[model samples]
Target: MTIKSNTRPVASAARDFLLTDSDFSRVRALIYQRAGIALGEQKREMVYSRLSRRLRELGMSDFTSYLAQLEAQHDSAEWQSFTNALTTNLTAFFREAHHFPLLAEHVKTCAQPVTIWCSAASTGEEPYSIAMTLIEALGNRAGNASVIATDIDTQVLEKAATGIYTMEQVSKLPQERLKRFFLKGSGARAGQVRIRPEVAAMVKFGQLNLLAPQWGLKEPFDAIFCRNVMIYFDKPTQNRILQRFEPLMKPHGLLFAGHSENFSYASQPFRLRGQTVYELDAKRGKGVA
Candidate 1:
């Protein structure tokens, strides 16, 4: 996931629609206001490349007209399309492998019927991985545990709920895990695997925007997997989200972050417990009561 810093259009002469600086700025503002994603100037080319397809599909000739139509319709379905377009969903099964072992060890100490939230569940891989880890850790008791997987993108969430993957997607997984957790597809569905019914039953998928005014989630979680999601947000937005997560977490609950993220700056409520892992500050005592 190397993002190119060059802001220049791929080929100005070859582009069908013109993306002026103003148009890009509007896009940046709109996305930030809606989803709290902070886009850098380097994303200019990426924005144009992604949004140009929208223009074509909508029969829009230029960014100006497209943006104007988007702004005028406050309840437009296009807004979701815009957010989904700009969102970067890079994920895989057992990504950042170290976290799973830590998770398995941590959940063993938590109360029975452990609840975990995969806050940025991209295409079901992370949540499924969590469910697999739980099954291995809790054995028969795993039936009582659950994983709540959520993403802001509806399209990806739909795909995630299907619990199916291409062979290439599951190639890196251990053969034992592949055999135990997934069913091999047949005939027309060859080369793809479907997650076992038991595994799929352990996870529940939903659409959630972290920036929403009311999250509506009632249960307190023993662990929250919000890895890599905060990188797209600015510092203020990140801090705000962490603040919101505090009350939803059970006492001594763990917060797993991406390898590149650091929450030490927000030391009032969280402290680094391991590599990119955070726990409620001991002094905070029982999580934001």
Candidate 2:
């Protein structure tokens, strides 16, 4: 038997919220305040397309009232819905593979306890990759290495903490690494696997709004991976975020950004040492040793 596919477009009210510039502006601001993402003029339709679901879900008539409700609530579950709608989380295991080899090499030379921060650690693959790299490089000393994984989205973070994934999610991992680090599920838990307890323990996950003036980190990190996240912010907010993050890096510590992000504006404080990587200046004092 053969199945025939239907090509008729489904009816949608998705465009209803996006038809007005005023609605676009409100949405742009909400995204900026919540996630430091700037929606440009051309993004009016994109904003409308993304947020119309909230209008339907909240049973609101239009984007204006929905945005007003979002603003009125001091802290609401709607923010999660808003963020979930607006933010783009395109991440995979060992993406930008160059960075992992760089991490392994760097860890081999470090004498002190290493703490690496994966700033936009969506779903935890990056931090887990860091853990695996540190283990490979430092061997018996891997226990001394720690990774802090953060994102503004709490929903993904909860999933990251569980470290359970379908086979496809673990497909990129080498067979040996996969077998070493993941425990395969069976029976009712079939087709899923969880990270080994030791590897999972190396990471700490938390919610962070990078735009906030004060980040609650108690110690400086030896390295920071803020990759693929800065493209969303405007220049000023990007500069502000860099200013805030710079002080938290150890002198001579490494900072890695997305391939598209650059530190040219903040070059006086950090020297661009490699592709999307910067090093804190020697003038900065030894931080949190």
Candidate 3:
């Protein structure tokens, strides 16, 4: 008698859509080409989970069919949905507490009419935090300051533009700041808070892709808060982005990165100023205080 087989088939039956290796590879390439995000091997499950919702919404049964449709339509709006689906928008108000103080000091030294670029606006928290800091630092002069908040995901930018947040989202803020900056809601909108009009006005939300050829921004910034964004890109992508950032920044401009990111490896245009904060190299940074 032959021994019974102990092995079983792979569990494609359990998944709503069959994501073959080929399908995942194509997705990885497409997103990298479009958005400059490098998906690693461990992200296969995450890629499948996020894209599966899109497939389900489109009534598709397999990744192959969905990806084929996506590839065929060069000018499809679905491309935005796909990019939005894969984007990770994690942020909180003053999440990196130290950076704000440094920014406050940096802007004080700059000329009037300060401008900042929050490269990954992400639900509006970071840019709003930057706005609040500018107000606190510059006081009445804050009227001349502005934040250009942008993200690759249009969906998040739409949410960011609303400037509303649940109480839970603002829970950690001090009572004084809460009263000063946000309007508490009531009745149907209880437990929600809307950013005050004055604070909201300081931020202009837009959609931008880091990989895009032209950012369409004419003004060079006094500071660029590209925080926590470069981690999603690979080394070459990071270098290219850092290179692009150099020309966009004022001589004394600061680049605040994520806590976990280190730019010392790419130390040509920037040097570590404090913690994850960077400033233009001294040789390249002359002429400005």
TM-score of each: 0.94, 0.89, 0.94
Off by over 4 Å in 1: 1-13, 282-289
Error in Å for residue 145 of model 1: 0.7
lDDT string, candidate 1, 141-231, tens digits = 9999999999999889999999999999999999999999999999999999999999999999999999999987878888999999999
In candidate 3, how many Å is residue 12 off? Answer: 6.8
Best by lDDT: 1
lDDT of 3 by residue, 64-101 (tens): 88889999997999999999999998999999899999
**Residue 240 lDDT, candidate 1, scale 0-100:** 92
Residue 176, model 1: Cα distance from true site in angstroms: 0.5
| Model 3 segments more than 4 A misplaced | 1-13, 282-289
lDDT of 2 by residue, 177-212 (tens): 999888999998799988899999999999987887
Ten residues in sequence with the least summed lDDT for candidate 2 = 3-12
Tell me, what's the RMSD of every candidate?
4.0, 7.4, 4.7
Q: What is the C-alpha lDDT of each candidate?
A: 0.90, 0.80, 0.89
Best by TM-score: 1
